[model samples]
Every structure is written in structure tokens, then in C-alpha cells.
Target chain A: MPALKKKITKPPTAARMVEDIIGCKWSLTVLSLVRSGVKRPGAMQRRVEGLTAKVLNERLRKLLRYEIIEREVFAEVPPRVEYRLTEFGNRFGAVIDQITALDEERS
Target chain B: MPALKKKITKPPTAARMVEDIIGCKWSLTVLSLVRSGVKRPGAMQRRVEGLTAKVLNERLRKLLRYEIIEREVFAEVPPRVEYRLTEFGNRFGAVIDQITALDEERS
Candidate 1:
């Protein structure tokens, strides 16, 4: 088994955390889409434009794991499923918006 | 040759651009380190803590390509080299700072 690194005086910094969140392209885009209410998996797949089913599914699972986005499943013939931003996700969305605004300034 | 897709009415959004920057773990962390004074290749390798030499070199090359950071090479026996963020990089850093601040709020 792989040993876990001991926690030192300081844990990983906030900067590093942000780096991880933004490091995965699908996560960033998926989060943005969820914030915009592209709740259905198919709709979200359409909204992000270039992501393949494999990658989108992977990202969604990770987001669910992170609790940034909540996934809901309904009992129906087709099994309706939806995703929405959690409160934590909203805060993250605000930060992403700021980054978008800055990129706009550059353009 | 892969055919270039025609430019649509809307180009890729600013959010998409930010997504690309943050999507790569190395690029995001590299920009953060360069914003600090860890400019030399060896020093940067140490400060980032876990990146291999190959990845660091790759990220540095990409940053240089983006013109977000400028590289300075001194003519000397050991060939001293350094990197500094350009104005564009400084603006990018500000956006990163906001993201970092948001992460802190959550923590």
C-alpha cells in the first residue's frame, strides 16, 4: 500500500487548490455549465461543445465526488438525471466569472 | 492535414479561454510560481515541490510561447537563465489571486 504523506505545519495552500480545480479542462467547463443550469447530462454535453461522452462522464463523477455539484436521479422510464451547483459551487462559479472577466479585458 | 473549422459567429468564450489556462495543472502552478520570484529552472523545480524536470521544462516552454513570461538567458559558463511575468502575465496573476482568495474563503 502507498503511504500517505504526513501533514506538516502548513497544508497545501489555497493557490494550489485553485490550481487543481482549474487544471482539468472538463471540470472547469462542466462547472460553468452546471452553474448556468445545463442540468441534464445531455444538455451539458451540448453546452460545452467539444467534450466527448467518456470525458464528460468522468468529469461529472469527479464533480459529484467533490460535492461541488449535486446530482439528482428521478424514477422514470428513462431515468431522469440532473445536476446543479451546490453553494460551494456557486462560490467557485463567482471566481470563474472573475477569471472570465479578466480574459475579456485582455481580448 | 486536419481541416481548420470555420470561425462561427461567436468565437470561443472568455470562460473557455480561462478554462484552458486553468485546465492544465502544470500551467496554472507554473504561472503562480513565475509570479513569485522563483524564476530559474532549478529553483522553480524546487518550489513547485513535485513536478518532474520534463514537465517543468514543458510548462516553461508553453509559458514562453504564450508570451506571458519572458525568458532571460545570461551568457556565462553555466548559462544562467531567469523568467519574469510580462504585463499580460501580471493581469493573469490578478485573476489567479481572486481564485486563490475564493478558495481561502471556502477553507
Candidate 2:
């Protein structure tokens, strides 16, 4: 019984979680945009050719949940919301930078 | 027409290619094992908790296609085959190492 349980149960590893976050093509594009200083939702949609509002929101929510990125809402006449990487997220981005570096190094 | 075509066609970037490779959870596990020096396919199947021979072979073939890992066959009576990372693959591993580092740094 113990052996079966051990075989069946694998913890949600940080690495696995990271992999899940980056696996989606849209997620990778979103993260890349955010990393490259495209912060607001509108700008992100514009920068990347076909990123729609619905999908962008979904990815943003997922990124927020992972603590890889954060959202900030302003108190102006029209509330301007922006997203940016958290401290841990910035560190996470550095790892992703390695992926970007992989292409550069090889090229 | 050119603008429409440009919007519709996004070139396959190297980073995206790398993402597609690591996107497989099993691939990540297999690469982790290979990086840790577990070389043989049979040994790899035994080492991971629930990895089936079929799935492992599928992953191995995919990794080989991406040129991430290579296989070698010995000339002994009982042929011995072992897999190792290529030069490009070792560099790819370094990006993966950054991900492993992310967990360690936070913990």
C-alpha cells in the first residue's frame, strides 16, 4: 500500500510548475512581452500581432496566480491597470532569459 | 496584402523551438535524469515512478529529433546503448539549470 502510494503521488514541484507556466505558446508570448517592457494590456495586445483581449486576460490571470507577475491599478480619473513582474518573477524572468540567451549563444 | 500576411505568419523562433521541447513534462523529467547521469532507456524507465516504456521511447525519439540528446551503441557481444547531451544540448541544459536554481534560490 505504501509502495503504491509512493509511486502514485508526485508533489507539485517548483520546476514542474514553472514548466507548466511556460508551456503554453500564448503564455510564452505574454511573458516575453512583459519582460520586454510592454506592461499595459492594450499595449501588449498591440505589440503582439494577434493577442486578443480574452486570451490576454486569461494568461495575465494565470501569471498572476503563479506569482510570476503582478497587477497595479492607478487611482486616476480612469483607472489604469498595469502588470509587472514580482521580485520572484524577475528572478524567474532571469531564468527565462537563459532560454533567450540559448538562441543568441547558438546564433 | 503584405501587412495581412505579416500579421498572419509568425516565424518559428529558436526560443519557441526550445520552449516546445521543454514543454513536455516527461521530456523535462527525462532531461533531468540524463543531466543527473541516468543514461540508458531501461534504467530511466526503472528510475522514474510511473514512466512507461512506450512514453519514454516517444519522448526519447522527440528529444533526438530536436538534437537535444544523442544515442551511442557499443560493439560488445551484448550491445550497450547510452544517451548523452550534445554540445547544443548541454547549453540547453544550462537554461534548465537556471530553472532548477530558481527553486533553490527561493527556498
Candidate 3:
């Protein structure tokens, strides 16, 4: 006789994904800026507007850790730094952009 | 001469909206459940899986406060309670569903 089997199930919804996406305060903002072509960290801060220096730095670090953004350092005087969205991050950005567009259209 | 007016600018992105949507840990979960047609508060708790009674109650209150969900108390024995998504909440739920669909497609 075959052994009785138990089926493992997964949550039908994307609660985990939603949780991961909105876990950070500045994630969406950072993604938006990166999508808008602000690759430099300094410029990202400027584009986000109203984000404090400390918060911006922390968010950038978090984004880097999450692999949502990549950091590249130039081998030059003063070390030019650039941050760009990874493929995954770009996909997330597209979702955010669509949501933002829908939200704006409602206004 | 017209005064050189300062542009009272608004944040170009939806930081506040994102913040508002994810402000509560259970907002997304609750919205998901409501969209799936689990209306009663008790049933909502059951559908979310892993949410505690306390958390579910608190989340329900928060969802009510945010106007994302509506509460209707039926005039009956023992007081029947039901919850439903407002129109705005339905729109938000559609976005969430789309995101969830995308996430699932990636798997």
C-alpha cells in the first residue's frame, strides 16, 4: 500500500512580496529616482526631495543589501560612485510607475 | 509687475501614498481577503492565516479608519458584523492583484 501523503500548501496571495516591497520607508522613492535616471547617490537624494541625508544614505545601503540596486565605484580621482537598478529592481519600478500613473490619473 | 512667484511644489512621486498604503502591517492582507470575498471579521481572520486575533482586530480597526474597508453591523441576534471594500479599496486591490500575478508569474 502506498504511504499516506500530506500536501504542502502555499499562500495563494502575495503577502510576502507586498511586505518585502513596502518594508522600507524610502524604497519606492529610491526606485522611482533610479528609474528616472538618477544613478548617482547624490542626485538620487536630490530627486527624492524631503529625504534627510541620513535617511537617504541608510536607504541606499538597504537597497544595495537587498540587491535591488547596484553600486559601482570608478577608479578615478575622488572615486566617482554610481547606483543603478538591477533587472529585478527595474521590474519592481515598472509596477510602481504603473501604480503611480494610475493614482495620478485619479486626481 | 507680477511678483516672481515661488513654485509651491509637490513631491513628483507617490511617497505619501505608498506610506499610507503600507502604514499598517495587515492592510494589504486585509485588502487581499476582502477582495477575495471574506467579509465577516471572523472569517477575515481565518482567511489571512497566521494573523492573531489581536492583530486582526487591530488591523480591522485601522482599515476602517483609513476608509479602505467598510463595516456593516446587521441588526440581528448577537449582532452580525461584515466588512467590505469601498470603491477606492477595490481599485487598490486590483493593483495588488496585478502585482501578485506578476510575482507568481516570475516563479
Candidate 4:
């Protein structure tokens, strides 16, 4: 019998996951707004400019699924909701800080 | 005359640039390979698996435009061309490290 070659498989890498999350349109914009203190959906929309509410909601849901951000719903007449970064999400700050430093270096 | 609302302009931020570069398909994969010591195009294509040469060239050109990676040409019989991360590109290590840490933490 002939020897069979082992097939190589590439699992979803952490870098790939990170790339997918940020690859979506407005994903980074939404994350940036949330990190900059704009937690409410309405606030993010206003700050981002041109990001439709539908897209914002989609990104928020995806971010939640990835455990990047957490959403809190308050029991109120209007059902207030706020989004914040989780511990894992906060770790992304280091990446953002490095990017900011690079930008500063360029400008 | 009625007062006019100041037009808000959001200049491209460093974080946005970083997102743009990494958002492209195979961008991170190529960078990861290079950072892992696979600096040749042929080696990168082989290691990344499924990345077409055309796409790799495009991503490399974009990365060059962003000043993320620098190219070196060696005078040899085959005219070897190699790519390596620039100082700015090396800074992306922080982001990748954070992502790796997050992945490890999750697992």
C-alpha cells in the first residue's frame, strides 16, 4: 500500500478572528466610539456619521458574540441599554494605543 | 445671517489606518508569516496556503504604500526580492500579541 500524505489544516487563528471583526464595515468605527465613551446606540450613530442604525446593531451583535463587548439592558420605560468593553475587549486598547502612537509618529 | 453649524470632519486616525491595513484579506496572515521569519514571497504563499500570488502582490503593494513593510532586493542570479516589516509594521506586534493573549485566555 502507498503511504498517504498528511493533510495540513489551518484552524481559525486569533489574528484571523481579529481581522474578520475589524474587516466588516463600520466595525472599527463602532468600537472606537464605544471606547471613546459613546456607549448608547444613538450616541454612536451620531458620533460616527453615516453609519446607519441597522449596521451599528449588526456590528454590536457580532462584537457581543465574539465576547469583545457586553451589553447591559436597564429596566426602564424606554428600556435603556448601554454597551461596554469586556476584560478581553479592554486588552484591545493596547493595540489601539500602538496604532495611535504610530499615527502620531507619522504626523 | 443665521449661524452655520461647523462641519465636522473626521480625519483618518491611526487606529483607522491600522484597521484598514489589517482588514484586507490575507493581510494579517502575510504579516504573521513575515514576523514568523518567512520573508520571501514564495515562502509566504506556501505557508499561508490558498493565498493567490496576485492577491499577495496587491496586499504587499498596499502595505508598502502604508509604509508597513519594506522591500529589499538582492543582486543574485535569480534577483531575489524580500519583504520585511518596517519599524511601524513591527509595532503591530503589540496588537497581534494582545489578540494571541486573548485567544489563549479564552482557551
- The candidate that wins on DockQ is 4
Candidate 1 lDDT, tens digit per residue, A1-107? 99999966544343453445666777788887887788898887777678888988898887776567898899998899999998876766676666556556667
**RMSD, candidate 3, Å:** 12.0
**How would you order the candidates by TM-score, starting with the best?**
2, 4, 3, 1
Q: What tens-digit string does per-residue lDDT give for candidate 3 at A1-107?
A: 99889897653223343444555657667766777778887776666668877887787886676556799999989899998888766666666655566556556
Cα lDDT computed for each candidate against the true fold: 0.74, 0.77, 0.67, 0.74
Residue pairs whose backbone atoms clash in candidate 3:
none
* Fraction of native Cα contacts reproduced by each candidate: 0.42, 0.39, 0.18, 0.52
**Model 4 TM-score, all chains together:** 0.52
The digit string of per-residue lDDT tens for model 2 on B36-61 reads 88899989998999999999989888
Local accuracy of candidate 3 as per-residue lDDT tens digits, B1-107: 99898988543233344444554567677776877788887787666678888888887786666556799999999999999888766766666656666556656
Docking class of 2: incorrect
**Two-way TM-score contest, 2 vs 3, winner:** 2
Q: What's each prediction's TM-score? A: 0.45, 0.54, 0.48, 0.52
Candidate 2: misplaced stretches above 4 Å? A1-23, A97-107, B1-68, B74-83
Clashing pairs in 1: A22-B22, A23-B23
Candidate order (DockQ): 4, 2, 1, 3
